[model samples]
Target: MPAHAPARPLEIAAAGPLRGTVRVPGDKSISHRSLMFGALAIGRTTVDGLLEGEDVLATAAAMRAMGARIDRGDDGRWTIDGVGVGGLMQPEQALDMGNSGTSTRLLMGLLASHRLTATFVGDASLSKRPMGRVIEPLSAMGAEFTASPGGRLPLTMRGLVPAVPIEYTLPVASAQVKSAILLAGLNTPGITTVIEPVPTRDHSERMLAGFGAELTVEPSPAGRVIRIRGEAELKPQSIVVPGDPSSAAFWLVAASIVPGSDVTVLNVGMNPTRSGIVTALRLMGADIEALAEREVGGEPVADLRVRHAPLSGIEVPPDLAPSMIDEYPVLFVAAAFASGRTIARGAEELRVKESDRIAAMAAALSAIGARVEEVEDGMIIDGTGGDPLAGGATITTHLDHRIAMSLSVAAQHCRAPVTLDDAAPVATSYPGFFSTLDALAGVALK
Candidate 1:
């Protein structure tokens, strides 16, 4: 691993009402799946516009270590020549996934089916997130794990030979766990089924299908049931991952509430499972229009046109949490700039993300003199309604990418610069965030 210098603290002055267009990076969820699916396929898979962030790079490294021939070209494209299903080798070094839970959890599934042994490690943030949810299902498939007592990382996995297939119903709404089980099923001997009560992101299903895996999804009265046939070969694919809606949320909120600011974000993902932010924002009276709607490489995408408008708070249901789980911190930020109050419930998952997002966002917003109430599952934010935020405070980022980005956006309307501890982690999801925002509006950092 390479060590880089820590980020310096900086300030952002309040911006004048503005207008511009910005395009964010490819979707993080889809980007991770691209690599994982490509590695599991039998032939060569080509990927364009993949996010080169550190976290996704960690996934690429882990796949290469698992015997995939993955390489990068000068054209900013990536190619992976896979070792075929069930052909993954036992990695010599412990897989270090850095700050990516998606990468670490999904890799565990692929490892569960083969007859191999491997260890997983990560940075401090990744070390803290519980992996037990994923471990339990994989364990039921006959794999064994030696992990920390509470199932934290620095864990070793012993893959199951003649792995048994399972009809697992998810206890929680997690795309990671569901995808893990489905990936494990790729090499098992029978049908592996997953029942998701609330559908999470569907990238794994769509990409798996595109790669020629035998998968069928049926919506039952019980839930959305997915069945994958085991020991099936996956063909190579040409993938063009869509832009991340989570990354687009910041701009969507900013443009929606900045009062006279208008912007267009091109080629953004409109996956139904991940479009809750757009839906919730529109429910709050956001002025947004979707244009050029089309399907690209098995994912739905469109151009989003947004303009500044008055926003009012609305009650967000717990059932919608799984769709926009990664966008809550910034949604809270948007709520702070809206009219009335925004109440979010059933978001306990926020507690275990890159940081305790609820606590981190609440503390940071309150420090800048915003009135916020943090609840067990979610937060209550009183909007400022275009009023200048009481700034002159530095926010603690806790090394979380969304926290760093959210606070940076809040600084745009604050009285003084809201210096963040380290913004370097933003690269994990939105590598060009600051620069793109800088070009669109006035944001200065020192």
Candidate 2:
């Protein structure tokens, strides 16, 4: 079967007085990593709170195709039987990654050092994304690729045993790219190093260490230097994935903008690298508080209570973009309800996501009767300033899960019901999004 999921459309209306507590799905990033790292580790890796989304499921399937035994039990925990390091078998067919860029790129890295060839395929959205960034680095490590034009997907990679280890600096701040190279380094001899000029999410580095890999991160004048020993063995781990901060972002923005809303999102991962949205919302004067701060599976966790607030926009710090890159669409929703203008810059990375998020958000905002200036890299939005938005319009999702969910949040403060061309993509990251939203907004879906 094709890994890409079919689409379903949705209509969102203004539901009054969003209240009570809800936990969003497990972190998408962590969920993908748990299966991947577990597949590389010997022994059984038990994962609790795995996001049962299409994207993460695709990763698990890819791992299975490569000889890892992964099973999701009736009790909701996942048990993975790894092939151990350097033990992956050549798959009989192309590995379909669906719409998950994290899966495509990271799997390429995992496949780079083995002595086998594998073909990768993705959905229409993922097929259009440039894979050249990954191909270039892996080629230097002696892996060979025959890819579509512009280095897009539907490509084949031939892994190189005893791949060369090099110290390379990243041209862009991408956790995916950084993680890809690090995973490739695991089976090479000696140390493989990646230099990050602007640090993105550090989940790979953190989780790699938790799986017993010898990895270290050090600060330098240039940036953060990460080194991982090669030909290493990974021990299995028992993991409890904290709720996704990115998924919590939609509600955070929703509760802050909608009148009379008091929402507490529980068990969210509070890793500094992934908490930029909360920081930006606080800066914009959103009444959001992080309560019961604690640690789980080596990452920070907390409960966030957000209340309706009159917000004023400010120029979002460019440096904060990497931390909350996935949360920008909803941040723009919050901006629509703020006073004055909110300008987000230095986020060119948004252009290469499942869609051109910069233009996508701009168009959706304009369709909902908000003023948005779409720039090459980011956007400038003028808030409705606590006034209800003129939202009797249908918005396009462009096969992006974030776009669908973000527009849904915008409907909370809209004067009329908002519709999405396709909300099914929400399953890529947050499958229970509509249901959770309905529960909080007091809307029943029949």
Candidate 3:
């Protein structure tokens, strides 16, 4: 069994409006993709602004085991010399992906079509997460998996000889699942297709093309059909990862929900494919100004200047859930302080993420004295609507990164301090979160 050394839990207190210019870390999605694509490409892929979080580091370790050479430069950039398509060597040891579902699932796809066997292990949190979704789809493509009972991790994957391509339609909207199948197709001999009914993040498709993979997307009545021609050589190129929109989401909600607050988050990745939270916040009457919009590394980027606003709640469209699936915890925090009611639908995906986000958010909101109702798929939050939150409680984070960040930010608008238990899990994504927020609040962690 593997153990992670835990950091001391910190208490965050509510303070006045935050004013500062802080550049957030690189995008986690892009960081993971860069390592995956770089490992599968033919030449050295240099990445600038890659997120150095634990989740992404796990992905880098997996790539190194598969025969890719990943090195970090003195200037904080990473360079990867890949093993190329069909060139990966069998790893000598079990791949420990820690608590990263993205790393585990996507690697399953890559392993599914290769001519080797690999075993994956993770922390208790990742070990408990279901791998059945990736297992079932990759199995259909001729991969064999033996997991713990209930399809959990510490699993072994034996790739099939003469692997077959698959036409898979995702039962749920998951980018990890989508990316897994797409990667499996890269080593197969024919066209592999995946149909996503609700649009999830398209970073995989975009990065695949950038790596010189033969991929195409066509709109269909059922959903968007993505087809990739198998057995194509991937050519490596330089990539600059964008700032994480999910991380920016916390700052966005904090600035709008806290009184007398005004802050601008710069160079945020605003890929329309991942902008559901912005749309939802705008619908709830957030005062957000998009400035100097431009393109970077084939994705949209902009400076978001957000100010305190009187927010009112509205029903978030269920179909839009895929774009901002990870932002719901913070969205719930914003909703807790809004004027009316905020209802979320089509969020069954939240049940399987880092923790049961839906349940966690409901409990925390209720604990902080906000009236919250948890539905099977989503939640109904009746806001104090800018009323100072009663917030003298410790929230259990359940090893979920977004949960801890959301509660930490939720304390900003409360009448009392908010403490989250087990915030050490936040290193999976936003590593500098508490220090950054503390700098903004002009206070020390006490």
State TM-scores per candidate.
0.97, 0.98, 0.98
Error of 3 at 14 (Å): 1.0
Indicate the TM-score of model 2: 0.98
Cα RMSD, each candidate: 1.4, 1.2, 1.0
How does candidate 3 fare on TM-score? 0.98
The lDDT values for all models are 0.88, 0.92, 0.90
Residue 287 shift from truth in candidate 1, angstroms: 1.0
- Show pairs that collide, candidate 3: 338-385
> Which whole-number lDDT from 0 to 100 does residue 79 have in model 1?
97
Residue 211 local lDDT, model 3: 89
Ranked by lDDT, the better of candidates 1 and 2 is 2
Which candidate's lDDT is highest? 2
Residue 281 in model 1: lDDT: 90
Q: Compose the digit string of candidate 2's lDDT tens values, residues 83-200.
A: 8888899999999988889999999998899999999998899998999998889999989999999999899999999999989899999899899899999999999999999989
After TM-score superposition, the amount by which residue 138's alpha carbon in candidate 2 deviates from its true location, in angstroms, is 0.8
Query: What are the per-residue Cα lDDT tens digits for candidate 3 across 1-446?
Result: 46866755878888788777777889999999999889888889999999999999999999998899999999998999998888889999999899899999999999899989999999888888898989998999999999988999889999975689889999988999999999999999989999999888999999999889999999999999999999989998899888899999999999898888888888889999898999999999999998999988899999899998999999999877989999989999999999999998789889988889999999988998999999999999999969888998989888888999999888998888888787899888989988889877764467
Task: Count clashes in each candidate, considering only residues at least 3 apart in sequence or on different chains.
Answer: 0, 0, 1
